[model samples]
Target: MRLIHLKLAARNVRRQPHRTIALGGAVAFSALVMTLISGFVNGMDSAIQDNVTLYSGGHVLVSGYTVSWSGRLQSRFADEAVANIVQSAYPEIRTASPISQTRATVVFGSREVQLSLRGVDWGKDELYHSSLILSKGDWKSLAAPRTMLMSAQTAARFGLSTGDAVLVRLSTASGQQNVTDYTVAAIYDDGAAGGMSTAFVAFSDLTADLNMKEHEQQAIAIFLKNSTSAENAAQTITKALSEKGYTVSRGAAPTSGALSASSESFVSSVVGSGAAGTAATGTTTGTAAGSSGAGASRRAAAGTVTYYVSTVQELAGEISSALGSIRWIGYAVFALMLIVSATGISNSYRMVLLERTKEIGMLRCIGYKKKDVFSSFIAEGILLAGGAALVGVILGLPVGFGIGLVPFNPHGDFGTALVQGHLKFVPSIGQLALILVFVTIVAVAAVFLPAKKAADVVPVEALRKTA
Candidate 1:
């Protein structure tokens, strides 16, 4: 029965080549628009994730509240023992690296730029390697005191490079300022984050230069085996830290139910439950953190810490949510286009049905069931939709790739500087499947009511109509 319906559908479509082409065109055009939008969204999302992973570790970020100088200053700290406990509790933790950050003024040859200097254990942290794309020198240079790695943008701004001397001034607690001269060990480019002027230095060297106190970590970056184990690992780690009497707070990847719920509620209220909601929710989870306060209070809270644990997905979601308006506008335009295309298909189908009335009546008179007629029409819609989807897939490749080639703000915002390079458009297989399924469903729906109407046509009346 299916084969028969397919045969009839194909034959009917072939009989009126122009109508078939028109229907197929509508479906193909709609699919193209959907594919383009989906590709853009996915591409942007991938870019953001790559950026975050480069800056922060892929797993967990532990930080304190009010330490928000771009994760530089710390009002709270994570004890070495707390990290030890979490490591022992969960074998899933691959590596643990402590980091400290500070804002400092970097000057060389009369040129100066404010830099977010990241202090990291060069030997332990893979994040520094993954996040930075070095143009010159080596990370090992940062191991020496008075040596630093400047971003390409920073290097350019300061008119400095590897082997060049730069002056760094930092503010201290005693209302004093300390100045040190450093050699630029490396120049790196990381789009907005690095390109906007940031620098990296050895944790030990940075501490010595700034006169930082012991047991003070702005944050701890943890890498895990996989994303599946990330949330549980964060929770277990937070719990262990709390049990060890530390004030913990969650950061980018919050595993706790309360924090997740609160974040979801907050996001839902802001973006509603559409793509915006998904994007916002994912972003929040990606960047959850947990923090422990420093001093006597931290000791008193032993075995308990305030921590924030956010998943990578959460960070992506939040960023997507933040950019929901742009996505929404894109989707809105696509939706309008889809409606117009579907309407065109419906009109074309209606015309075909009117012209084929005699044929339909003859089929009915020859004992073809009404259900068969309906099925045939539906099959035609499906065939047309499928052909269109195939064509869309083919056409969309170059178009999507071309769009990706257009350079936009790498910072993802219009206000910032334009990113100089092109982006590659990579489409997700899941997204393609979704587009195909959605288009097929819409085509079927448009054909359904009209199919029923065609099925309801009285055989005698249809046969009596003059061509």
Candidate 2:
């Protein structure tokens, strides 16, 4: 009986092609808009995560800072010790490398620029090397001492090329001024880190220049097999480190600007000039890792090591907030569109009742029950909405792909949301299914009152009305 009603409803839907098309168009438009907006937000979130994982830090970052008895703070950790603990304790860690980071002024002739300089162990940094999209030169050159890799924008600004020597001046670990000459090894696209100059130098060269001892590094960037496991992995790793007699602190990730400013201040304070016992940018929280233990009180002993653990979500900083805002805006737009579609569907169904009055009377005269009449109308609504939404999803995927292909400025304000200078659209299958169901329900609900009213009509009264 239900199948019979659906068949009749399907025929009725086909009987008036123009009305069906016009009515279905609203639902279709809503679905298409929702698909594109959701895809864009998902893509932006993914791009930020990938960018931070590749360039700045990893899925998880572990850094340590120490306070001297004289009230000075130093952000440094024993690389070998921390690496061993990280790899052994967490099976999720796919790759971990200790990186030395500092802010330095690079001088090419008379022009000088302050940029974030990081020391990378390229030999073991397979993920970084593989993910880097180079515009010019080769990574092999980094094997040589005092060689650096610069972003294409920075390289262009400095008119630098492979083998061109540049001067980098930085403060050593002991607060002494030191200068080193480096040759440009490679230039990269600078996708996520665009507008900010970030350069990479050999670990050996940077450590030696910074006067760091053997196996000492500022932070260890850790990658996992699954990126989403970052927060859980951070907690697990923090617990392990704390149990291993290391003072651990849970810290929020820093934005690029905050990181740079903090690094500069940290370097300047190495000579005992900055605030006394101030925490570095990497360590924001004072609480012990994975516990509610006292934050600063945990650093009671002089020269006590404090390890800070953060995840990519934390490290994403302002970009994360921006992505969230875009997501909520997308939802608001989707809700508004749904409301508009619902209003249209309700009004159209009311008109449908008027046009189908004679048909409804004829069916009632043929012994059709009121429930059968109501079910038929509801089924028609479902078919129209579901079919329209399906078409919308099908059309939206290609439209999204086309939008992604349109090139935009990587240096723009929303550049961080782009992937490799292009907008990325990631449509989730689950999200699509939910959208279809939601649209079908709203559309069916809109027809509910009209369907019920049509079912309640007296057969003689309905038959009296002209078609």
Candidate 3:
């Protein structure tokens, strides 16, 4: 009986070619809009996320607060405690590198610029190589403390390529200034580090230059077996360190401009409910392997605070917020399209039903019941919506495919162009399914009342009026 009704419904719909085209077109357009917008937003989120995770830092970063000497601000961290905590408690760590983090000024002849400087344990700098696009020189030379790496933009700005000497001046931990010359060993095209405004050196070189001990560091970039394990792993590692008689500092959520935050920055982003609310920019390219556990070990010292921990997701809070805002924008566009399509479908279906009143009444007078007529019209709507959604999805897939094919390389302008909202488009199957299901429900529901009204017409009255 259902199959017969469906056949009759399809035949009846075929009698109104113009109405079918108009109504189906409305649904198709709505589906198309939702598909593309959602695709673009999700894609951007992925790109920005990969930009940060694969290059800017690791899945989790451990650090302490920034201190100031005169007007120079610097961020500091101690590595031994963090390494010991991870090695002893969490076997999940794939690779970890200690950093000597600071902000400094670079001079090329008379040219000077402020930069975020990091001295990395080259043996375990997993993220650096993953995000690296070295246009000149080799990474091996950076094994020396006097050797440094710069961005292509910085190299161009200073008119210095690989092997060029650039003067660096830094504010020491003791409220004094220190100056040194670093030979540029390589220049990268990595955009996630904000181009040339961020640079790297050998960890020993930074410690020696700043007159610091080897057991200390500014931060530690830790790659884990799973990025999702960051919060739990952070807590477990914290507990292990505490058991060793180390006191951990607390922190608030990071300001948009800050790096791996201090102890006061921990509550909202690192170890608690704050992470529950975050809109995770999905993971990609997984954590890379590195030489795990190579740094100096710290004694189980009492009365000392180990570093604070923040995930790459927290480090990318601002970008995630920006990506979320774009999603809202996409939602707005999709809502607008839905409204327009619903109004068009409703009004057009009403007009078509008005023309079909006599046909409906005649069918009612025969063996067909009102519910039968209603079901037939509903089946027609289902088929129409299904057909329209298929067309829209077909149209949308190519667009998504084309956008995905475009590579992400935000080098020359430090991804400024991308930051301005030009981002990659990822073809997410889940998003596509969501759009199709939503559009289908709306399209089929829009004509329900109109079909019921047409089916309810009095058979005698409709025939008499037509006669």
Candidate 4:
């Protein structure tokens, strides 16, 4: 009975080619919009993951707070004893790398610029390589003493190349500045890091330059073998560290100086120096300059260390959260399109039922039951929606395939003219299934009232109406 209704519904749809085409076109258009939006959201999410993984490693970062410097600089780890205790408590730990970061000014000849210097174990921090694009030289050379990697923009600004010598000056806790000469061994260009103003030096070199004692590291980047063990590991590690009288903080912890100078520069670019000063001072009142100065000094006095640890899933979550607005907009647009499509289907089906009212009444008068009539109308809706969805799926393929050719700016800002070399589009089969199910459900729901109304029509009244 169902097969017969389906066949009859399909034949009925085919008989009115224009109506079928219009309905099918609507479905195809909606599906195409949905596919594009989903693809874009997925692409954006993937992009954020790539950036974060490239920039901050997977999801978790662990660090300590210092009283003396900005938030980024404050990363104090529990002594080796605490590290051991934490490791023992969390056996799921796969890899860990100690990291230290500082900001300093590098001068080459007449050129001078401030740079954020990150010190890390080159071998352990291999995950960050994808985010680090080297135009000249290599990361291996960073192991050499008095050698540093400069950002491409920094390199350009200083007119320095690989093997070029530069003087680096850093501020210490004692308010004295320490200067050292280093050779630029490599050039890295990643817009995510704000281009070439950033530099990376060896952990040993930074430690030696700062004259630090002990193998103390400010942060530890941990990667677990199984991401599911992350929360457990974090709990165990936090417990172990707490037992050792050390405070464990997550990546999202609030602290002063969390904003980098580059971030400040970006803000300054957007909102003038007054805005920058307000941000730096944390108040619009320029009156309390002295208090602000004192607060800055006090913040500088609190020397803290930061640790970051993230699972792959956590990293993905962070990315999703960051791109939440875009995803919401995409979903909203999809919903509107779906609503429009559903309405179109409902209206089209209602018109068809109205036009065939006499035929429906005549059939009812003969042998067809009202239940059969309702079922037949529902079958027609399902057939129309299914046909449209099928056509939509067919149309979506070429559109998805063509998205790769669409130009994209991998970097969020539109200032640069460089085209993204690679465009990625990955559509999940699960997501597609969900969309199809949603469309079918909406179509079925839309037809229900129309079907019921058609079944309620009196045989005498319907017989008076035209086909």
Q: Give the candidates in order of TM-score, highest first.
A: 2, 3, 1, 4
The models' CA-based lDDT, in order, is 0.65, 0.78, 0.66, 0.63
- Residue 169, candidate 1: how far off, in angstroms? 1.5
- Arranged by lDDT with the best first, the candidates are 2, 3, 1, 4
Candidate 2 lDDT over residue span 192-297, tens digit each: 4533458998888899998988777878889888889998999999888767655567775222222233443333333133223323222222222223544212
Q: Give the backbone clash total of model 1.
A: 65
Q: Quote the RMSD, in angstroms, for model 2.
A: 6.3
lDDT of 4 by residue, 1-467 (tens): 47767776777888899988887788777777777667656765565545544445433456544433332443343355545655576776766776666778888787788878877677776555645677899877877887887777677766778998989898542335799988888987655432224577777677667655456665566666644566677766766655554434443433334545453333234223332122211222111122344333112212223223344446456446645776688778878887888898888878988788998889889887888888888888878887677677667767776876765444444212112333445677777777777777888898899989888878888887653
Error in Å for residue 380 of model 2: 0.9
Model 1, stretches more than 4 Å misplaced?
A: 64-78, 173-176, 192-196, 227-229, 252-318, 405-420
User: Could you tell me how far off, in angstroms, the CA of residue 416 lies in candidate 2 after the best superposition?
Assistant: 1.9
TM-score of each: 0.79, 0.88, 0.80, 0.77
Off by over 4 Å in 3: 12-14, 54-56, 65-79, 191-197, 242-245, 249-306, 404-422
What is the TM-score of candidate 3? 0.80
- On lDDT, the candidate that comes out on top is 2
Which scores better on lDDT, 1 or 4? 1
- What is the TM-score of candidate 1? 0.79
Poorest 10 consecutive residues of model 2 by lDDT? 280-289
Say which prediction, candidate 2 or candidate 4, comes out ahead on lDDT: 2
